[model samples]
Target: MPGPVFLRGDTVSMRTLERDDLDLLQKYRNHPEVRRLLGRVHPQNRDKVEQDFEGYMSNAVNLLACVEEDPVGFVALFDWNESSGHAELAYWVAPEHQGNGYASEAGELAVEYAFDERRCHRLDAGAHATNAASRALLEKLGFEEEGRRREHVFLDGEYVDTVLYGLLAHEWRD
Candidate 1:
């Protein structure tokens, strides 16, 4: 049998999100740099953290990225339906740890899990039009730009386009 969490790459370890991760998630979620890149929806307080934690724990496909005991990032296979054998993957890294290839490592691991372990045929990622770093990272990890939804999300008093990317299992040879 496979472990509860599958190891993806050497740089970081992938594991299931647990209740103990609430504090760490809230810390990164509230960081100024992270908020600027990802946008903050609500205050990451105790109540909000707890509520989010509940959803993560209940979601079977939720995955957390860690460096030893430190919570570095999170990757989740969201909006999954068995009949489709497909899932959308989303991830976020701590602001302080940006540009260290942590996100790419986390992403590679997520893709491996989706393909090799979960047997998923494809993985999809969506990034804001202005988020060049995110888009570049996804491309480097073998995700191809599928399309763009112009002005789909209204953020910061303006609508922004979202670029959709997809990576198939066969494309991730590395």
Candidate 2:
């Protein structure tokens, strides 16, 4: 079965998550390292993944980042408020694939899709205040810091601040 191709980068392509991709997705999403930064609201079990794949996916753009058919990461544009032309951006790369620019590549495509194709005026992303890597990536993608929410989420053992970032359509180069 063919999956929907939403956007393409130089080394990675972002495609809609398909039913056949559930197992492959589970492998990445359930990884301890990958899940640590996601601020996951629920466990990524087979049942929930399948359920979300079928229902929640329809409201947002959730794409897998693949390199020559091998899944390396994921980019999601969720919580879209069309009336406000805004959405939340999220992504995670496998432990082995970090520092390769795959996430940035996939993120560029997703942000383009959100601003250029989807006509969204703003895209929001938040990272654990301690996550320097994500903060750097967001900066590389032209996202500006909006503010920080102190002790916004409880993760691992204690609460972590949420560093908010935003990109506006007018600020997009393309």
Candidate 3:
């Protein structure tokens, strides 16, 4: 069974990722379509997935994005700096679940949790320059395009640019 829901939105809910869900997580991590945009170039095994899961549990507010108990995606606020009141956000929806507005709604919930519950001052995110959908999602969430890193990540056989985005707590409308 999946862990209890930690945050809930109108159509999506964010839940603590559990050990029981590691297999699904592994599937997502290895899926070529999902991994490409996620900047994951190498295939991941179950052992590696479990190891990463441990790290996520210790280091981040990593959650599974779900809709009515069906897991659809993943979202996280990681690399948190309590003293600096800042963190980074990352999220991805399964290909089958993409375009259903789950990513957007889950992202809103994560942003709210970061600023209100976690009391973060700013949140940062990045997307591959070629990923229009991810870029659009960040913009839709009130994040500003801060800058771009030229040829920052190697994906699908060549280097690609990364577009950085940031959102300040005071700047967040909700």
Candidate 4:
């Protein structure tokens, strides 16, 4: 509900993103396959990362999925406004951790925070249509597809539709 902190679930635990996580975050950053799946942006260097962390300080809603003290992935809630009582969710599981159910588990806890703890009325997110894995994860978490924006993102040299999905506070199940 406030700043990110350690969140424990059955199979994994999520901790707040920290500057000390640079090495682990960089591991994902430098992995070619991981970068490709994350949309192949220009590689991030140390200076850029330093600035990125500085930016996160103001935005400030983020979580890191961990297991046995090892960094596995990240999940974040943002776009917060007290009056609106809603926030957008986003997450990424490292390539090595992709098939382990980490995102879904961590995502559930984040949703709980937004709806139960933070008293948020709605939670929403979008994924590229081609990202079947992400789409399936959202659906499994009870999010419904609301709409799609055709050719909204330029990915891999071609336009891809962005699929919007959402779940209301009343729609959530434990």
Check candidate 1 and list the clashing pairs: none
Cα displacement (angstroms), candidate 1, residue 53, comes to 2.3
**Model 3 regions more than 4 Å off:** none
Measured by C-alpha RMSD in angstroms, how accurate is candidate 2?
Answer: 1.9
lDDT of predicted model 2? 0.86
Per-residue alpha-carbon lDDT of candidate 4 for residues 1-174, written as tens digits (9 for 90 to 100): 112446789987878877777666666766776665566578878776668778854485777887766777877788886698888888888887889888899899899888988898888898889999999999988899999999987777888998999899989954
Q: What is the C-alpha lDDT of each candidate?
A: 0.77, 0.86, 0.93, 0.80
The residue-by-residue lDDT of candidate 1 on 1-174, one tens digit each, is 112456757878787776667777677778776765665766789788788667643664666777774667777787665577678887788866778888888888777778887788778889999888999988998999999999977677788899999887788865
The better candidate by lDDT, 1 or 2, is 2
Clashes in model 2: which pairs? none
Give Cα distance to truth, residue 57, candidate 1, Å.
5.5
C-alpha TM-score for every candidate: 0.85, 0.92, 0.96, 0.88
Assess the local accuracy of residue 1 in candidate 3 as a C-alpha lDDT between 0 and 100. Answer: 54
Off by over 4 Å in 4: 1-5
Question: For candidate 2, lDDT tens digit of each residue in 14-86?
Answer: 8777788888777767777777787765668898889878888878787888887677888889999999999
Model 2 TM-score is 0.92
Candidate 1, which segments miss by more than 4 Å at Cα?
Answer: 1-8
Over the stretch 68-173, how does candidate 3's per-residue lDDT look in tens digits?
Answer: 8999999988999999999999999999999999999999999999999989999999999999999999999999999999999998778999999999999995
